[model samples]
Target: MHLTDHDRAMRDGAEGDAIAAAMDLLIRYGEGLGAEVLCDVRNVAGTSTQPTPAKTIIAKEHGWDKAFSVINLDSDADIAIPPMRVPTCQLQQGFNDEVLSISPYRSELVELQDGAESFASEKGINILATCTPYQVGNLPTRGEHVAWMESSAVIYANSVLGARTNCEGTASTGSAGLTGRIPCWGNHREETRRGTHLIESDVRVESFLDWGMLGYFAGDVVGEQRPVLSGQLARPTLTDLKHLGAAMATSGGVEMFHLPGVTPEARTIEEAFGDTVPATTVHYTAADRAHVYETLNDQGSSTDVDFVLLGCPHASVEQMAEIARLLDGRKLHPDTRLWVMAPRALRDVADRNGVTAAIRAAGGQVLTDSCPAMSRTAPEGTRVFATDSAKQAHYLPAILDIEAWFGTTRDCIEAALTGRWKGELR
Candidate 1:
């Protein structure tokens, strides 16, 4: 790996044990990737200090700092790591702390989450527990280099915002918090950002679900290759893009995608591919989306909806506003549980705007800092689930081993109120 003078100094332990450790970790990681050099990263997102199955239970039982060093830094050495040098944030925690008393979730996990938050706060990581960090105060502008871990956020940063990131993970990004550097490779390279496949869709995308359907189909068609989309696509909102990126990451290993005249990086088709035509092209129709819906929805036509989950990448304040508007005068069915998770920052704004209040008053909850995708703490006997997100509907059935259905926001809200599912796209 290529190291500058200061990097070499740090490597030689000139910067103390903590920085040396961080530098050593980064060098090994860069070497593993056959990277020739390292680049400066201004921003970073990484794993919370929350306990995971792979983390040592002893460190968790000991204290927060030890647990953080063990889980995040990949080093058990008792070195006092410095505060985060670059702007750093956290991905969402495992479960919603708001439902501690209401749900049957283990108390230990909540306590661990609290410990993790405390640890992160002390380390100068802006504990913005969210998958969509750009929605909050951690927005990275075009051409900026960031070390983000969340799959959806990474793709959005590279594809939509024109930022550079290579999908850094928990252990790898931990070093970014310390050194503000990462291996210069993969999506961080300008040549690799060009599209490899061309996808043309004739069907118009209407809502977030439709966008997600298109993304799911696109992911299946383009596997790990970057695709340039040129089609009769409708103008989509931020929510639509978020859902599409999330579903794309879930259904396939798509690190980035380009839509000419849509995403910042792709102002034109020629620009999207760097003036080189894609090696392959795939065409999609409305019938292809129908087939994906049939494959993703596992409820098998059963209407009895027992659980309704709205947020997978965490709901935005705008989404909460829409949800509050829908449940203004209506109450959820007594037998059904509706959970809508959002970032803590957005949740606070939602609370101040009376958006969370409206949902709570209508028997639905606006949760914060957690999503059910990572943790399945559903109430007793929730066999049938319905969600507005195609991402959740695609994975929840396999993760929870329950019947799951996908529908629009209105359809999901209606199902929550009536305990019956009516699949509607919009």
Candidate 2:
């Protein structure tokens, strides 16, 4: 592969060893993907919280200063970085601790520290720790280019926001931050941006859970192709779209999907497809929605619930308000531990709206910057767990060995209030 003058300079150690090595890896990856020129990446989202030894060593060797000096640090908008770990259910206690202990100096935490110092020495970039960076104003407007690592964020930005980006990995996003360049593939190209799969839903979705189920169903059928959704439903809120994006990403390698009348591209079904949809269109019915729940929960009779978690993309202020309204004078079951995850901004809004007080009064704690599914912090030996997020329920069992129940926010609220899994009708 031919290298640009800038790429050649990096190879010649213009930025020192660490950066040069990182750049070499990125160049190789770009070459592997047949990317001739790197697009300018104004914003970057990553997947891991801690840096690996290789990444840290590279950063340190390059003098973190020169490695990430190209990023715009004055922005208050948060960047969606990668999760430190993938969702897993292997019952290895203290797994993360072991990894961290062995590679203390290398991790997202260390990288974040290094990044903080590097950014501070230059300009301070806002760090909002969550997968839903777009929610906190890091959105790339229509046709604008960006580098995002989080799968859901990539899908949302590309499909919903009409912004352009490829589904990148943690290392690639980091490289983009350092060099401000990304391969212009996938959603970045106009030809690749058009919808390939046609999804027609006959069922009416009333809650965020419904959207999650729809996303899972669409992803299962659509695979990695961009799906253009059509047919009946209310306009989904940002929270609803978040669940949809997360569930879709979890189900498949989908990085972008358009919902007619909701997403920027799909103002109409025809617009989403540019009048050239696939001959076969998948129709989602009530049975399909039920199938989503059944597949996620697994066929189980155990109803003894121990944990109830909410917020996948993290709850928005409106959802928090709804939770507060539902639990205004109620208390969670003493045996059931209910946890709500929200972004720092929404958490503050919840506090101001008295939603935080209501949730706390009802024995639920609203945490900021992280979700239980992402953190792997659910109580050990949790036999029966419930959540409003299909993505959470789908991945949690494989990593935690817990029986998960999928339901709506109301269902979770009821579970918290009663401490029992509300069995879905098969």
User: Against the true structure, whose TM-score is highest?
Assistant: 1
Residue pairs with colliding backbones in model 1 are: none
lDDT for model 2: 0.69
Each prediction's RMSD over C-alphas, in Å, is: 1.6, 7.4
What lDDT does candidate 2 reach at residue 331? 90
Cα error, candidate 1, residue 17 (Å): 1.6
Clashes of 2: 16
- In candidate 1, stretches whose alpha carbon ends up further than 4 angstroms from where it belongs are 54-56, 299-301, 424-426
Provide the lDDT at 342 for model 1. 88
| Per-candidate total of colliding backbone pairs | 0, 16
True lDDT of residue 303, candidate 1: 83
Q: Write the per-residue lDDT of candidate 1 for residues 1-426, one digit (tens) a residue.
A: 779998989778887777777788889999999999999998999886645754537445666656656666677877776788888888877664668765777777777777777778888888887888888877788888889998889888888888999888787788888888899999888888899998898877766778888888888888887888878788888898898888888788888999887778889888899967789888878789788788777554678998899977889889989988888788999999999988888889999999999999989877777676676767567889888787788777777788898878888898899999887543
Q: In model 1, which range of ten residues has the least summed lDDT?
A: 50-59
TM-score of 1: 0.96
Residue 363 of model 2: what lDDT? 80
Q: Identify the leading candidate in terms of lDDT.
A: 1
